[model samples]
Target: NSSVSCHIVQVFSNSDEALINKKLPKELLLRIFSFLDVVTLCRCAQVSKAWNVLALDGSNWQKIDLFNFQTDIEGRVVENISKRCGGFLRQLSLRGCLSVADASMKTFAQNCRNIEHLNLNGCTKITDSTCISLSKFCSKLRQLDLTSCVSITNHALKALSEGCRMLENLNLSWCDQITSDGIEALSRGCTSLRALFLRGCTQLDDAALKHLQKHCPELMTINMQSCTMLYPSCSKSQMTALWFVCLAAATSQITHTHTESFIHIACVFLRILEAARCSHVTDAGFTVLARNCHDLEKMDLEECILVTDNTLVQLSIHCPRLQALSLSHCELITDDGIRHLSSSVCGQERLQVVELDNCPLITDITLEHLKSCQHLERIELYDCQQVTRAGIKRIRGLIFNFIGCCVILGVNCVLFC
Candidate 1:
């Protein structure tokens, strides 16, 4: 309340204008203005030229968070702030700033050379020109989010890789224009890169994976959801069925051909892999993944209908540290597949979260198989019609609340306790 009163007096000085101005030093006034939000600071700037200068000081604009004012942030507003911030800005988040265009981004890139974190998520108007400017100026950038920036192509990625080698985390999800070439260039240049989100990038194939395997040794997380072209075949169901049929005869041959080269390179640090809806990834592809990515802790294979018990068995045998696994909508998986997973060393000792949502074929027997999994915490069986309340009740450490035949289990049950 006292702070609000002081701010009011600082702005609306009446007969005591001279007294208030003489009493508070400029340094003290600037410090007080620093505590105010951007909107409040803008209001203070309207009071007087002295207050305007202090409110719009470079120190006050070091980290401009426009997320709260997403609807209000326009190209002119960002451009004006960039002009004022000069070189002092370190973090700028314009997430969902629909009106932000390439010109504003260009101005920000030119002025804020020291910016380390920039979030331009859903900024549809931005093009490759912004990326070109950023690559030329923002060399210290560590985290960049260009999610849903559809116009961004390989040219922008090439520029970024050549310039911002310090980039650690990048989210390129929904950037459909990107391909293996740009990803390869990035991996080759940004050796320190750790987490990459390529979800919905349909153009990326095994070639991109090979590039990451060869270059990014420190890479830990990769999300390739909806990348249907990663495999050689177009029809995921037929290709997977063929792979499963030939699995016995071709396991050694496929492993020798595909995994021998980069198996060691990938097995070291790769931890999390989410390839949901990538239908082309069959047992052969998953075999290479399971064999190489031994340190994989979390994996999501949602809607990957081709994956059979063989892949789960391989994951169980190879990835002893495996903890979280999601096989949602994978119609091919049966109790036999889950039994293999539960019997595995990792499943018995370390597996914690398991999501089998929409897996229609899974019965109560599947839950019975999981009794030996002492470390098991949470199991999601949403829409699994075959699993009855009595079957779910048999599992120890999982207590269900039966409310009119609807079995609801607390998410916190045994998992956190």
Candidate 2:
């Protein structure tokens, strides 16, 4: 009799739980749904009134990650959300969303004034109008990532320069449309800028960087990866052509060939050439560079087809304060250059990160000598055809095979990571 009563009680409890789920209040459901993603939260509006209120809550609408949203849908959603809940928003990521027009961006800029981080990567539709509005409203913005946003011209950047004076980390990678005027504006306006990325922005030449060095004295880290223009080819003729290109590109007017030539020669020694996609940068150009920027601490000669081990030898000897070095895809660099690097005074103390990617000339012998480097932290030898298993094994042993460090245990200090 007792066992039968217990079974009946279990069935009643199961039915009661189902009844509670079915009769749950809409407000309670919405309150519980506040922690969902934007997509999921928007869908919860179909559930009931309480769910709708929760979805529309100003606090819950602060962060908007529209990376996966459809462009047209994103525009409509942003319009609705901006009307209802833009005041409390702190972070907005519109990465790769193309439908965000000037109007929608303006709405965000005006309404979401407290935004801290704004990522607009690959949003090619944004023009100077968008930036102008952001400047007028988003004053407290700290981290702004504008990577690959090619449509943003100088006028919009100038607006940002005047507006976001307190900006810290600003990424303009692949913004090929930006020129010296934009950089000059930034240097004059946002003097507090710290970290800046100009990767693949090939049009930024030495004039802009020199201006930045003059004004933005507080700048700490500047990633100039693939900015071929800054590392211009060292020659009177090349410099003349480069200046002509810069002038013509900036003013939309052609320059006199003779005047360009004269200026090129006058500024030849002042230039610090980068070996990025410049096939003409040979040993001769490096000789000029060595004479010019003897204080150069960071050098990257990636894909510089003309650079040889002879140039590296000279660079290691001359650039004694060199800290970070990238010689990736320079086929001419060999064990001779590596040996010179290992024996170099610069290589022993200051060198931190060395990228020898795809250089078939490097071998196990290079690894053996790299162990001498004390400050060396990151070493990228990705796809080096000559690097064998034995070389990597030796590297692993050096980083991990410490006998006296047995008490310290599992601290693998391999340079690759």
Candidate 3:
């Protein structure tokens, strides 16, 4: 009996020894470490020397998201990560990291040469030097967000265009210093670009847009909110030249007109356009956009004082895929415009959200026209003084089949049913 017990104990000891000596593959270890957060990984580094090396391995740190540690992400921490990651880092987001300056960016640029996605939004201290460093080193970069980085100038854009040829999505929103020259350079160089955000970039004008039209034939989304300088105005000479070209093409042959039209249509691929508060954009400019960008899905023309019912008519006719539209503060839009929109095939089928905030001319009849918008989900009628409680109740019942109760302008009214 003692011999049998000894044999069993020996077998169990051998099994335990084999299990203790088992070594996991390095790739498996790195994959396991990748699941841990930065804080947890730092803690794991203290477990042992092997664990420390594995925790700081470059393969495991390919995509570092330090957005959660925005306030705590200082230059030192960024420098340490950059040093550890080496060139394997593919994505790094330091959004709202106020403490991160040019030094941290320089560290990243020097080490992470293969970085493709970078978000430095609201990093106020980063300047043109950082851009130069990124452009020089990270040639494979694809998406860069420099939103509210006010210090960056045209030099940064020029560097990006010259070096980062693969850039696709760029957000220069609130970078106030960039002008048509920088934009022209970007359009000329970055032909693969798809989406561009230039909100509050007040220095840009129609010439920059013309450059984009000529160069960025694949552009899908462009946001120029508050870029008041980009007015859609063509000189008489330009208009005459365009008309003469069209006429010549038409008179040359039937195939010539078709070829010219095809080229014009193929150049514009804009899907989403936001030009809110661009007070300079009139009927002429809006018409140009409507004629070119017929595939528009979402459009914001809020506070565009020059846009009247004519613009709506054009949009209703051309933009068949338009789902979300904001015409807020466009006082010129009356019941006629709403009627035209509601009566349109696209409006009845695709129209979803409509904002008419502070539109003084809109009356109760606008709601009656909107009843035809079967797919309409939400509509804002804030400060439309002409709409009465009776009209609101009537429309609420007609549309929603439920009575909506709300207070607007000190009167009990149905806002949206």
Candidate 4:
């Protein structure tokens, strides 16, 4: 009986040794596993209780991209992580996490106000109420992406501008309901605004830009691309001087048009221009850009219907070192413009990246000419019906896979097998 008891004890001792002694130190294990991609790292969580804790810790969580782990099940998991992480989060990305409602957003905003980067793209359930709450709670907002948050109105922006004055980078893109009034308010309030993307905010017009020029002087980058209403071409030459003054006066009679005109005339300087969807902007407005902003790099003349090939033919002649140009949706641009671009001063080399999205006029003939460009890295041809598959056959393909199926297609912006 004593011998039988000794044998059982020996078996148990061996089992404990095999289970615990060979286990790796948690710190060492996490250090080794942190290099793995999100998928492989997530698998580590299922290994044991120790691993699950390590994987969800702030150190490892910082690198794990939330954009990839986007499923109905993962929403609750991420929220739980937010609650567990306390205040250690530096960058929080909840992009495309549809289940994260206003309450979850408020919880995050209130807790993670110290976040250096926050991406709330496609979080449709988030309304102006969330923004109002964030204004009071999140004062350290630097980089914010409110893209596709359709419910955000002027009230939300007003709240943010009044409170989050430290905001340097803001993307209000695709918030179509936003008007020039909201933009004017932001321009006046967020004086430190560096980069503001007003893309697809159709209600923003010339009045907004005029306001920005007056108030947001420190603005380095502005993306008004596809802002169809603000198309400078739509505004009459007379409105360039009259509309802004009239609107400002109507609001508060701050300064009369004639008085502002005299001041502008004394110091003739019109620096920034982004007349992408403005079908009315003729060579006249472009001539103003060519004269001023000698250091101007970005020019988006896409879908400016009045801007014929002749306009570009002149712009290339004047703006020699133009770096980024997007001539998307400009159906009128022909080989004449492309040929001029191929040989002119602002030709391939001086130009770094150019977007020819939906410009049917550009074929392989133009693309082949563009291949001569040295620094050109990205070329967006999303809906360009004319570009055949042969155009980008040589470029290496990257797949944005979601679990098993790909959602964003690929470089060409079309369905891929």
**lDDT top scorer:** 3
- lDDT of candidate 2 vs native? 0.66
In terms of TM-score, the best-performing candidate is 3
Q: Write the per-residue lDDT of candidate 3 for residues 393-412, one digit (tens) a residue.
A: 78777665223323243334
Off by over 4 Å in 3: 1-26, 47-50, 231-268, 280-292, 400-416
lDDT of 4 by residue, 232-338 (tens): 22221221221111111111111223223322321122233454455545665555545543444566666666555776776677777777777877777775677
What TM-score does each of the candidates earn?
0.74, 0.61, 0.77, 0.64
lDDT of 1: 0.74
- Residue lDDT tens for model 2, 337-370: 8888767887887777678877889887887777
What candidate 2 gets wrong by more than 4 Å, as runs, is 1-36, 43-48, 200-202, 225-228, 231-300, 304-326, 336-364, 367-417
The TM-score ranking, best first, is: 3, 1, 4, 2
lDDT of 3: 0.75
Q: Pairs clashing in candidate 4? A: 231-278, 233-280, 233-281
How far off is model 1, as Cα RMSD? Answer: 7.6
Model 1 lDDT tens row, 368-403: 777667677678777778887667766534533221
- CA lDDT, every prediction? 0.74, 0.66, 0.75, 0.62
Judge candidate 1 at residue 130 and give its lDDT: 91
Q: List the residue pairs that clash in candidate 1.
A: none
